[model samples]
Target: MFGPEGPSLRELAVQALSSVERGYDLLAPKFDRTPFRTPDSVLESVAKALAPLGPFADGLDLCCGTGAGAQVLTGLCRHSVTGVDFSAGMLDVARHRVRPTGGPEVAWVRGDARALPLRAAFDLVVSFGAFGHFLPRELPGLFTEVHSVLRPGGRFAFPVLAPPRPTRTGYWMLLGFDTVMRVRNALWRPPFVMYYRAFRLGTVLDELERAGFGVGLHALPEFGRRDDGSPRARLVVARRTQPAAGNVNS
Candidate 1:
């Protein structure tokens, strides 16, 4: 659901018809006002979870639309933070909106997340609400790029909600959404690739392990337990494990 300042149904329709990059560019101004942006509660939960792992010297936010996760980096990393996105418009909004109020300096870089420019350059990396744009096949390179950017022992973290059960209404909702996206991509010239069902946690953990991260999950207690008593959401913290030299002295 969107607020008064958010995009109207007509505006959302127009965005859905456009390519992912172009749609994000069009939506950048109202992104924070929409449901698409990561909520502050989730970000706060993540920041608290990551605090014990700090203090990092530098960090990067992969596919950082409006830099919500990147803002978390300012508190975790003591030195600098960089927010990168393929959409110039999104980066522009991030530059002005989430500029570091904490001690760490911030920079906005316009580039693709699949082929990040940095190498072993950051102490930490985080992303939020941007995974639906990438197909499952692209995750290998996406994880690799995140691994490449982080200093060994550095973390590549993000929140992943539990997949809905087969009988659940939410399951059908995602299944229907993915099916519609596939049909749209089949008929449309430039595809709109946001699909809720594409990113699976189990499959994702496998991909991340193959990409050289020692993966672990931390339960976000604030979201509470499901009916089965399993935590409904977790922060996937994948640490790059190369050698002690890549380790954080702090």
Candidate 2:
């Protein structure tokens, strides 16, 4: 669902046809008006969930489009917050939009998440609504990059919704969306890599473990629980374990 301030259908078509970076650049200004932006409710829920675990120092928001996660980090992190994304356009908007008052200083960096430009400088890292851009095979490398950026005992946290069951219309809708994306990639140049079903929680936990994070899940009570008593949404809190022999924090 998009508001009147959101991109036009024609504009969206142009974006969908472009490379992911260029597409986001074009959509950056109107992103918050669209459903693509992480919802404020979700952000608040995650902040509440992370508050007890933190009194964190420096924080990083990986793939921080428009700086929503960075805004959250300001409340929990004491020193500084850095938002890194590949799209310069998105970073531009974030720099202008997310100024905090009497809180952690915020900075924006333009870089790929696969190869971050910084050292292991962050005590907490958060990402929101950006993982679908990465394929399942890329999870190991992506998680490793996240691990590398975090200080020893630092956390990499993000929220994941419980997948809609087959009985729900949302399930078919996501299935159809992914199928369309697959078909488009097959026929189009410079594939747009958004898939709703690709990031499974079980697979992600295993990858986090292999990347040397001690993974845990915290239920977000705001979203309530499913009929089976499992959480409807959860925050994956992956803490980077101390480095092995010969591995340095820096």
Candidate 3:
């Protein structure tokens, strides 16, 4: 649900009809007011989860819309933080909005996540609420790109919520949303790809492993647990196990 400052229904309709980059560009000004932006609670929880594992340098926020995740990196990473996104408009908003004081230097880069412009340049990489833009088929390459940018033993971290069960109304709600998106993409040109159900934990872990990450899951206690006593949200920490063949440390 969007607030009064968020995009209007007509504005949202226009964005849905455009390409993902163009849509986000159009929505950039009001993205933080909308539910689409990653929540502060989630960011705080992720930061808490990552703290013990870090003291990192040179962090990157993959698909960093408006730099929320990059703001988290400023606290954890010591040297610098870079936010890379395909949307110029989002980067512009981030440039003005996400200036953290007296910590790591923050920079913004415009680049596609699938083919990142940097190599072995980051000690950590974090992404928040951007994976839905990538289709399931693209996961392998996406993970590979993340791995390629991270230095040896560096982490690619993000929080993932446990999928809602069929009995929950939230389950139907997400299913409906994904169905509508699929239909929209089917009928529209320059398809806007977003599917709530597409990113499965098992499949994603496999892809992360295949891309040379030694993956681990950390339970986020802030979100509590499910009825089955499993964690409701988890931080997926995928560490790059080795350096690329010829990557010079940056």
The candidate maximizing lDDT is 2
Q: Write the per-residue lDDT of candidate 1 for residues 1-250, one digit (tens) a residue.
A: 7889999999998998999899999999999898788989999999999999888999898898888888888888888999999898888898888755648899988889888877678988988888998999999878877877888689988998888899889899889988988998899869998899888889999988888789999999999988899998899999988532333341
| lDDT ranking, best first | 2, 3, 1
The list of candidate 2 runs beyond 4 A from truth reads: 244-250
RMSD of 1: 3.4
Better candidate number, 1 or 2, judged by lDDT: 2
- What are the TM-scores, per candidate, against the unseen true structure? 0.93, 0.97, 0.96
Which pairs clash in the backbone of model 2? none
Candidate 1 stretches with Cα past 4 Å from truth are 243-250
TM-score, candidate 2, is 0.97
lDDT of 1 at 22: 95
What are the per-model C-alpha RMSD values against the true structure? Answer: 3.4, 1.5, 2.1
Cα displacement (Å) at residue 74, model 1: 1.1
How would you encode candidate 3's per-residue C-alpha lDDT over 58-98 as one tens digit per residue? 99999999989999999999999999999999999999988
Q: Write the per-residue lDDT of candidate 2 for residues 1-250, one digit (tens) a residue.
A: 8788899999999999999999999999999899889999999999999999988999999999999999999999999999999999999999999997989888899999999998889999999999999999999889888888898899999999999999999999999999999999999999999998999999999988888889999999999999999999999999998552244543
| Better model by TM-score: candidate 1 vs candidate 3 | 3
> What order do candidates take by TM-score, descending?
2, 3, 1
